[model samples]
Target: MTWAAVSARRLARHRLDAPATVGGDPVTRRIADVVAGTCGAHAQVMSAAEVSVAMRVAGAVRGDVRNALWRDRTLVRAHGPRGTVHLMASRELPAWVGALGGLDADRGVAVGEPYLDPDQVAALAEACPGVLAYRDLTATELTQALADTVGGWAAEPVVDAFRDHLPRWRWAQPTLGHRGALCFGPNRGREVTFTSPARLLPGFVPMDGPPALRRLALRYLHGYGPATPAEFARWLGAPRDRCEEVFRELGDSVERVTVAGAGPAFQIAGDPTHHELPRGVRLLPYFDVFGVGCHPRSLLFAGGAARRALARGQAGNYPLLLVDGQVAGVWHQALRGRRLRVTVEPLVRLSEAESDELAFQVQRLAGIQGAEEAEVETGRVTVGPHA
Candidate 1:
C-alpha cells in the first residue's frame, strides 16, 4: 500500500537488487532475462541501453548486449513503447509485436489531419514486411522501395522530422513495427538498417492482438504494478481509452488496490502486496526503464528530487540518482580518451557510505563504457533539462 513497498518490489523485479542471472551462457541469457523482465530496454542510444542492461545483470559487461542482439540473436531491437526504439527479447517478440500492433494507430500525437489515413498506413505497413524481408536496408533504400510500391505520396518528406527530414514511409516505420512488419537490423557500418519480425523469427507468427495485448498488460502490471490506464497508455503511447479497454479485458486477471500515495490503481491478481523496505543507491542511465516507469510522481520524485532530477516532469531526459527507490539527484557523463568522467549532483545529502556506494557505481559505469578508469566529481549538475 505504501510507495516504498511498491518501489521495493519494482527494484527486485527489475533485478537491480541482485543483478539478474540465468542458467545458460552467463551474459547472453542474463541479458535476455534483464530485457524481458523489464518488458524492454530503451534503445534509442543503444550504448546507453547496453549500460542499462549491463548494470542490471551480475558481471555483465559491454559487448554482451551486442553479442546477444547481433551474434547470439537472443534479442531484437525494434520500435517499442511510446513509438521509440527498444531492445526486446527475441523469443518473446511475437507477442510484443502483436501487443504493440494492437494499439489504435490513430490515437497518438500524430492524430487529426496531420495523421496519415488508414489507407496510407496500410500501404506503408504492407510494403514494409516484403521490402525488408530477409534483407537489411537503410532509410533511403526503404523510402525508395516504398515509393516504387506505393507511389510518391509515401515518399514525400511531409512528416515532422524533429531533428531531420523524414519521408512518409520512414515516418510510418514505427506504426509498421507495431504491426510486426518492421524492426531494426544490425547496423551496416555507420548507417542503420531496417528489417522485419518475420525475418527475425521465421517460423513463428505473432499472437493475436487482443490476447497479446492482455498478456503484455498483465506483464506490465507485474513489472510496473498498481499502475493506471493513463500511465500504461502513456508508456505504450496509446490513448487512455484503449488502455482502459485492455484493462477491462483483463477483468479478473487484475484487482483494484489503494496505494498510500499513488491512490486507486490496478495490480495483477495474487501478486505480492507486501514488499521489503527498498535500500541502496543506484546510478541509472537516461531512459533506464526503472527510471521511466517510476510512478506516483509525488512520492518517487519528492520535493527537491522533483526540482533537481526531472526535466520538466519527463523522467528519462537525464540520468537518475536513486536513493532507496526515490529519485535523489541527477548525473551526466563524458569520456576523456580512456578515462570516463562522471559528475553527480545529489539533491539530498549523502552519508559517507552512500558516497562510497556512488563511487562503486561510477566504477561499474566506467567498465560498462569500455573505459580504462573513471573519475567522479561531486557538485552541481549545471546543465538544464535534456542537457
Candidate 2:
C-alpha cells in the first residue's frame, strides 16, 4: 500500500497539540463528549483525570467531573484499555465493555490461572452481578458478598494484580453494568462502591464484541490516528494478532500514511490533512491522553526529554511540559495554602517567549486545580507524592 508522507509537527497538530482547545462541534457541554473525544480519559490517578477533563472543557470545574461520574452518571469509571481505570462515557459502556471484556477470554489460562483457578473465576463472574446488583458496595463488602455467594475461594486476593484486583474479578467492571447489573456508586470516603448500571443509567444497551471493537478502533484512530497496529495493541493492551485482525477488518476505511522518522502509520480515510504546527506551551497532567495515547515514544519524547520526563519507560510518573507539541520537560506542583507553586525542570534551555508561555500554562494549571494564585519557577524540583 502506498503511504502518504507527513511531518511529525503536522501529526502533533492533528492530535491537538493545544489540547485545552480541541476544535470540532463543541461537545464540552457534555462530560460524555469530552471523555469520548480521547476514547476515554485516564482515571487511575483521580487528580489527573479531573485536570484532563477540566482542561478540555471551557468553564469546567473539578466538581463538574466528580458530579458527572457520581451524580449525573454521564461518565462511568471502569477498567478500560490497558486494564487501567478510565472514565468512559456512560453511553459508550456497551462498546467499551464488549471490546475490553472480550480480552479476558483471549488472555487464556496463563493469565487467569495465576489469579484464580478458571472454575473460581467462572463462579465469581456468575455471582458478581448478584452480589453487586441493587447496592453500592465497597471492596470489602463485595469480597464478603462474593464469598457468601460463591464460597471462601471467591475472597482470595491475587498476587501482583493491579489496582483492587482482589477476588480476581474481571478487569472491565462495566461489563457487569452492560448486563444491566452493576455500576460504580459514589465513594464512601476513600472506598469506592458499585451498584447497577441499569438503575443508574436507565437507557444503556450493550453492543456485541465485533462491532464494539470496530467502533473503538475507529474512534482511537480518529483521535490519535496515523498510528500503527502495534500502537493500537499497546494502547489497548490486547494481543497484537487480535489488533491486526481489527486493522484488517478496517481495510479500505483507513488509509496508510508515512510519519516523518516514525515510518508507516494509519488514519481514518477521508479525514482532512493537517500541516500546521501548533504554537504554544502546554502543561499536561499525568497520563494525559495526548502524551500517553501516541506510540514510538522516541519520536514524541525525543532527545534527552524522555530521560528527564519519564521514570524508566513509564509515562504517568510525572506531569509533562510540552513545547511546540513535543515533550520538552517535566513539572510538579506544590500547594501552599491558597498559592500554587508550579516548578518546571526543562531538559533544554527555553527561549524568553517560551518561558512566558510556560508561565501562562502554569496559571492555567492553577486555575484547573482551583488555586487562588500560581507562582511559576524554573528549576529542578522533586516529583511530588502524587506520582
Per residue, candidate 2 scores C-alpha lDDT tens digits across 154-184 of 6666544556445555432433433334556
Instruction: State each candidate's clash count.
Output: 1, 0
What 10-residue stretch in candidate 1 is worst by lDDT? 104-113
Pairs of colliding residues, candidate 1: 101-178
- Model 2 poorest ten-residue lDDT run: 1-10
Please write out the lDDT profile of model 1 over residues 1-387, one tens digit for every residue.
888889899989888776776656667977887789899999988878989999988777878989999888889998888878999989888888788776644454443236467778877878888888758999888889889988888888877766766786665777788788888998998999988778877775888888988899888898889899988988888778988999999999999998996689999987886467898999998889988875877888899887777778888888899988888999989988889999999888999999999999899999887899898998988776664
TM-score of each: 0.94, 0.88
TM-score of 2: 0.88
